[model samples]
Target: MIRARAIIDRDALAHNLSRVRALAPHSRVYAAVKADGYGHGAVTVAGALAAADGFAVSSLDEALQLRWAGIDKPVAMLSQQLDATVCEQAGEYGLEPVVFHETQIEALERYVGPALKIWVKLDSGMHRLGFAPDRVDAIVTRLAALERIEINGWLTHLACADDPSRPETQAQLDVFAQVTAGRPGLRSIANSAGVLGWPAAHADVVRPGIMLYGSSPMSDRDASSYDLKPAMHLSAPLIARNPIAAGETIGYGATWRTPEAMDIGVIGIGYGDGYPRHAPSGTPVLIDGVRVPLVGRVSMDMITVDLRNAPNAKVGDRATLWGGGLDPDEVARHADTIAYELFCRLTPRVRFEVI
Candidate 1:
């Protein structure tokens, strides 16, 4: 048996995708499977998310993972550096590369490969990757000159759609609309946040990232608010249960002290397995559905949790780290991070199981 593992729930994975559809009913869904399905195991979830119109990945290699796994749906490469060689491979594999910079467009214009499918990205205020909105005219005109290139869609990323009240999202959407007016191919802007918050940003396609993996794209709300199920259940076995006296310090730095004489369960998980080392005392865990507060400093391979909530928890009971009953977003908040980091940073030492 695996000491610690992330159980990928296929039904929940599909349910999350359905949630995206529910939110963006008219748009084609490009389920973001980047960062190895946000660390839920890409290929496995890709196979399960087959209902998605397509899959979005961060790099060319990630796109290949889906293709190699026999996923024939359109795979969009969101951040792969486009070059002559990269363009050729993209053409061969039918991958759509998001060409944001002028140099990338130059690479596509110069490529004599069979044909390439690509998405033209507009900066739209994120100012991260896409071409500036002012350049959209020249971008559209220049791209019109390339016979070998096909615009799979005109897409942009939202910087603050998570906060629906943020004016920047509306301004960005306005800029996107003004720039791409009367243009041809599909238009996409809604990430998971936009999909949930700004229905107007859902153009011809909506590429949802975190929500598909069962994490909230918004801070104030949770996945359950949208009826999204947790797709990844992370847990580990309780390796030891010991009695501790009041004032007994636990783990490194003696950061946590027992408030009273009680039993503490040592779970087989830690930062080494992607359970946040920064998770302070009072972070919650679950044993047999009983909520247990995490105590002490997390080590590379172990963490101690106060078992007051689960007096029946034993040495072999599996402790739920952030799924099933407990929300990953809640755990992420206690760790002073977001669920995305928790999902993406999980080390390979932790076993992954697909259900």
Candidate 2:
């Protein structure tokens, strides 16, 4: 079978997590491994980071997958499919749930058995989810009544940490601090961007997601500046090489036309394997560690790359669509998206091999 492969470097993951700890020395690191460790494989990444302080995931199903793999760390589900049975399952696996609204708290009270660890999510700014920060008192009071509930922490999310100059981040931090001011338990407000940019928001815990996987959290910052190494390098072998004449066009829409006779190499990876389809011409790819340019519209199972610089490019040569010598961030930028989407979109059809 023709294989598109991802090389995961466990050492790079360790370095990335270590960088997180260095950035926020006073705060505990919670590695957000949701979306199957952002498409790097949850169980694999979790096991690799077994020394990490804790793991944060999106749902009970994710938490259960970690539990099945023998990861015994403290796990907090950032959000879950709210239901009675799953609430019980969260407790069963020692997974903490984010209680954002009154209904979830009430459900936890009714369905929870022994001890329930809940991270109360406050909507300081990211209106996507969480209870109103001003209503902490009411939410606290409701949770305090449950005999099995242990209010482990106060949590909030940053709306603009990715864009450092946006004053909304500081405003959100101020709001978060105001509400969590006197709370005895842990207070967490740092996502990857928050961990890198907003130091004041790093309270008792810092949840670093993309950064833990060695990708830049902000549009402007380089991941290397943080000493974060990319954990995954996606590559495939060249399948075909052809020389197109000056008048010929390439790919589905014939989006690209050759201006001169040029050698083009076909890489055995495509949108089906999570390579972004919208990648315009001139998007960077790597042939034997030398940069090459993408030449056409990406297809469901293949991508054509310009091999002018790599005159030695051949049918069996390795092509790095992203990862290895070429960074995923560069490709993401050309595609006008974030590294998060690029990483998470990598599908199961691509084989994974840990290095």
Candidate 3:
């Protein structure tokens, strides 16, 4: 029997995509499915997001994964420094990749296969990827000179679109607009945060990542506020339950003790399953759909939860880590991390079943 599993709800995924369409009606949805669809399984969600205009990935192999899975939709490899091999694979597979360097242009020049489409990535203020605003024209010119390639458009990443209170997103948007002025092809600037919080950043292409999987892109809001549904339900079985006396400490490091005599359950999941190791005591876990406080420290393969709130919960009842009734953002807040990391960090040990 599977002790713990992450249930991927494709219906919820499709519902979220509909939300993206509503938010950016004029833009194409380049749904981000990189990091194996944020650990929800890339190929799995691709089928669910068939309505999306295309997919946005992080690497050539990520694109190939979809292609091999029979997903022929346009897949754009997001802004990155490309190598000769990656460029060749991209052309061969009909992928639209972002290019910023002269070396990448040269590699495309050497490619003699089918015609390729490419996007020039400009550093709009993220400073992580993309070419400088001053160098975009030169790079675009060089890329445009390639006989067998199509300059799909310009691309830029927003630094602080997650919170509209920050001015960086607008500054980045301004830089992108000026750099790509009178430029050929379309412009893509919105990620999930941009899709939800910055309508001005919604250019010709909008790539929604975490929000497509049902997590809120902004800190000030929850997913429900955006009409998003929970797409992944993580749950583990309660392995053991024991009555503890008041003042009795629990688990490794003796980090928590019983405030009063109450039953505690041993849940069959922990860091080994990609549950955050640093998740402190009092993090909420849903026991048989009832909220229970996580007690002590998370172990390699187990966790302890106070059953006072779930007095009738049985040893074999499923305990939810997040999703469904519990918001992943809420769980993330308790763990002091974002929902993205929690989704991407799941190990292969956990069973992933599509629903």
Candidate 4:
């Protein structure tokens, strides 16, 4: 068997969801399982977070997958672009469609079925796929007579809640409140960032995504802030250790030349396994709780890390590429990206072990 594997901790997932619950005590947490639980495996993460108020998926297909896997929680697709056949399937599978645009509303109205649960999306500020805040009343009035369509409530996405001090957060909340004022239905506006940093944004339903996977959506927060544990530990066993002389190039393009003689261990994971190819040297990795620096260019199937600080590191020594001691956020920062990309980019080449 290959030594490289992804370890998924269900306990960690539960812990993180609990933190979201605490943060938005009065709101229902819609666990975002989109992008396959942001790469932790959707069905697995959804099942693990079954205690959540509900689940959120990206498409009707994802919702169907969850249903096929026997997850019966209410799943709201963040985007709804389904055809008549797909919309019927959604009704049959008990998936909620997020109606954002007038066109989607028209489609759903045309496909009118008995089991369709609708969640209207209001464009408070993101300016993405959602009804304009000012048009909420007219849209609601139009849909109120559609007996087949179950208008459950409202949902909005936050743009800058990740920046805790941004005034835009309050502006969005005010707009959302104005649109949803005294509505006798469910109201939702919080994402992971909104749940953690913007208290006013937390309405009847809070959608927590990145945080449920043990990542802080807000740059101002970290894993420790909310008592959350990382659900994924991407690791590989050291394949070999080679000593290089000073002034010799280490990897492709010779991007990093050794300043002195050093012993480095090769790990059996690379871009093929979803590690970033552009990850520069000095990216922090963890081996037995000790920090190691990645050296040289990452290849399709291998990477070399300086083990001088971890002299005892040897072949078969565990290399935590991310998670545990090393935060995936830091790696994302080094790659000029976010944890969402880092997680979803992990290919199926690596084995996944759920704990």
Off by over 4 Å in 2: none
Q: Tell me the tens digit of each residue's lDDT in model 3 across 32-107.
A: 9999999899999999999999999988888999999999999998855576778778878899987866677778
TM-score for each candidate, following the candidate numbering: 0.98, 0.97, 0.98, 0.97
**Structural RMSD, model 4:** 1.3
Candidate 4 whole-model C-alpha lDDT, 0 to 1: 0.87
**Considering summed lDDT, which 10 consecutive residues are worst modelled in model 3?**
79-88
lDDT by residue (1-355, candidate 4, tens digit) is: 4766889999999999889888888888889999888999999999899898789998988888899999888999889686788788888888888988787777777886666888988888889778897788889887887778888988889999999888888898888888888886799998989888888888789999998988887877786777778899999989999998988988899888888998878999999999999999998888856999999999999999988899888887789988877888888998888888989999989899999
TM-score of 1: 0.98
The parts of candidate 4 lying over 4 Å away from their true place are none
* Per-residue lDDT of candidate 2, residues 84-160 (tens digit): 88778877888899888778876876874768788989898889889886678888888888888899998988888
Give candidate 2's whole-model lDDT. 0.87
Tell me the whole-model lDDT of each prediction, alpha carbons only: 0.90, 0.87, 0.90, 0.87
Quality of model 1 by C-alpha lDDT = 0.90
| TM-score of candidate 2 on Cα atoms, chains taken together | 0.97
lDDT of 1 by residue, 85-177 (tens): 999999999999998999998788879988888899989899899998777888888888999988878999999999977899999989999
